[model samples]
Target: MKSTLLSLLRTGEGEFVSGEKISDQLGCSRTAVWKHIDALRKEGYTVEAAPKKGYRLAGEPDTLSVHQLKSRLPEPSFVKDILHYPSIHSTQETAHLLASEQAEEGTIVLADEQTKGKGRLGRQWHSPPETGIWMSLILRPDIEVRSAPQLTLLTAVAVVRGIKESLGLDPEIKWPNDILFNGRKAAGILTEMQAEPDRVHAIIVGLGLNVNQDYFPDELADIATSLRLEKGEKVSRTDVLEAILKEWDWLYRMFLKEGFSSVKPLWEAHALTMGKEITARTPRETLKGVAVGIDDAGVLLLRTKDGKLHHIYSADIEV
Candidate 1:
């Protein structure tokens, strides 16, 4: 309802939209229209109401909103739609359910906080309220199951470019998923799939980015960080998200048309793990080696101490 009301008001940009017209269009009472307008004001939007002229948008805040996000994108946006939640268990969880029910491709699930945020390898992602970008993008790509991990690399590049553009920060990709500044974690990508043996249904990519966190809990103090922590000031979450979405839209089209060949160099340029000796902890064994590079299929190629190259499909990388 909020989104619908926003759309109506936005159609008459730079002018007032009458309360009677809003109620008629929304199929609600005049009182309801005023209440919704008031709600928008409380969310930091400056909505000016007049006696007979009705209401108009006076200002917009540096916050997240479905209406604002949609306005930022191009018409017939590559993003099919974005489902926004102020707070939820996990955007990835909701994305999985939506994708399973045959949601359209390019749909995004966005949230301000996640009570039970998810991470890779059954880990819990810490998602504090209003301080991060917590969102999941659902993709139904025409690619084989073996090529899924490439999307993770693709997303990492998008995020790196996004942060660099938005905050003037040089963030690097810690192979497979994490984005880090210096050595502390700034963001992570968790990719989940609904697929068959040889086919694919949906790829839900969840990104948790620490945007304006002033401090971390004791456990995360040493290992975690945020853009604000690094920049000595606050940053807008919506600005970063908008930049990422634009980058993702461009890269996704290129990926679908060309393939990983185009994305390899971009990922490698921002990759922090490449050419470094690292320890990898997989489910079966622990291996120590120098991180070489990822293959065409997005598999990490590690050259161990004994001079043998190993194909690592899944692991926790310690650099």
Candidate 2:
């Protein structure tokens, strides 16, 4: 009901809509309409209510909610179901629970802040309130467990494409999952999966994108940056999210039809690690080498100075 009222006011686009008209359209009393408008204001919507003019939506807040995001999405199929939280331990953990309960594909678990947010190799992701995009997408892909890692690369490609399209910035992909802007980290992708040996269950792709932060903490000051910091102005998080979903939907369908072979070239085009001297630190050991490229299974292929080729299944790369 609140969403409906808000939508009506938004459709008015700063013009006043009478309380009587709102009550007639929503089949509610003027008092109820006034209550809903009050609620909208409380949720950071600047709704103006005059004596006779009724109400007008003056401004929107920079917050992520089901109402705001759904209103911005181009199609319902992009996000069939969305779970929004003001603050949470982790969107990835909640997404896993929802997927286990048979949540539909394209369902999203989003939060303004994540208390226990994580990145690859179990590192903590910095997700401050209302300044970054902390969301997990639940995907049930019909592929083998060995092929599941390819989705991470595909997601990186989609994110780069989305950022380019929305912000007009060409961010570079740092091998496995980091998105960099001017050599500083802008986003990270963590892809986890549940599967049998031969078949797959669900893949949860978690994305943490710094959007509107003015500055990072001392620990992250050297490496982390936000869209606003890069662009020198605030960019719409809704627009970035929508672009990502559209790119994800498009690339996912392409991957399904043509496999990772078709998607690998696109990922390579925006890659920052390729053809660069780097060090890859895995669980067992670290190796310094020139990053040749990715192999057929999307593993990083590193050519060491000793001229031996190494396949990296999972590693942290430093360029």
Q: Judging by TM-score against the true structure, name the best candidate.
A: 2
* RMSD from true fold, candidate 1: 6.7
What RMSD does each model have against the real structure? Answer: 6.7, 4.6
Cα lDDT tens digits, model 1, 211-289, are: 8789999999999999999888778887888888888888899999999989999999999999999999988999999
Q: Per-prediction TM-score, please?
A: 0.82, 0.82
Clash pairs, model 2 backbone? none
| Pairs clashing within candidate 1 | none
In candidate 2, stretches whose alpha carbon ends up further than 4 angstroms from where it belongs are 1-60, 71-78
Please give the lDDT score at residue 305 for candidate 1.
87
Residue 130 miss distance in model 1 (angstroms): 0.8
